[model samples]
Target: MADITAPELKQRLQAGETPTIIDVRETWENEESRIDGSQNIPLGSLPDKLDELEELKDQEIIVHCKSGGRSASAKAFLTQQGFTNVRNLLGGMQGYQQS
Candidate 1:
């Protein structure tokens, strides 16, 4: 899976490169704060929620969680599920907030 840094992602978004951003953090985490426009799908529910992401299979998907662990797992799972353009937001939202 591809790995993208927070600054790179920010630049891409600023440049109008609107990739699908998936937030794999839990509901509580999402309630606390999240990147605008990111789709929230907690890591635990992803397997059952595959259909929700079907349309994104062929697109550039950026997965992220509180840090990077959950997103890494999500990236592997998406790859196994045949998503070719999956990527993990390196350091996740925490890194983005820091930046």
Candidate 2:
């Protein structure tokens, strides 16, 4: 997967599709606000948390950061780790806030 827009992702969530939403922001950033049901894992700790995501490797994953940059990196890292269905949330939470 390439990237998913906030509206599209929100629709998918409302429809109950269980794609894992990974928030690759720092703890303070996450505490400020985050997508409901998203997993909080800072970008730097992603490598250490790889095992935590093992079972989700086969599932679709939607990653987001404050403004999309970190999420893009997260997407690349996940792809390298053999996650077949990973997507970066375009525009990240800022986009979500808009709609």
- Cα lDDT tens digits for candidate 1, 1-99: 569999999998889887899999999999999888898999999999999888888889999998899999999999899888998999898899998
Residue-by-residue lDDT tens digits, candidate 2, 2-95: 6899999989989998778999999999999988999899999999999989999989899999899999999999999999999999999999
Give the runs in model 2 whose Cα sits over 4 Å from its true position.
none
Scored by lDDT, model 2 comes in at: 0.92
Clashing pairs in 1: none
The candidate 1 region of ten consecutive residues with least summed lDDT is: 52-61
Question: lDDT winner among the candidates?
Answer: 2
Candidate 1: list runs displaced more than 4 Å. none
lDDT of each: 0.91, 0.92
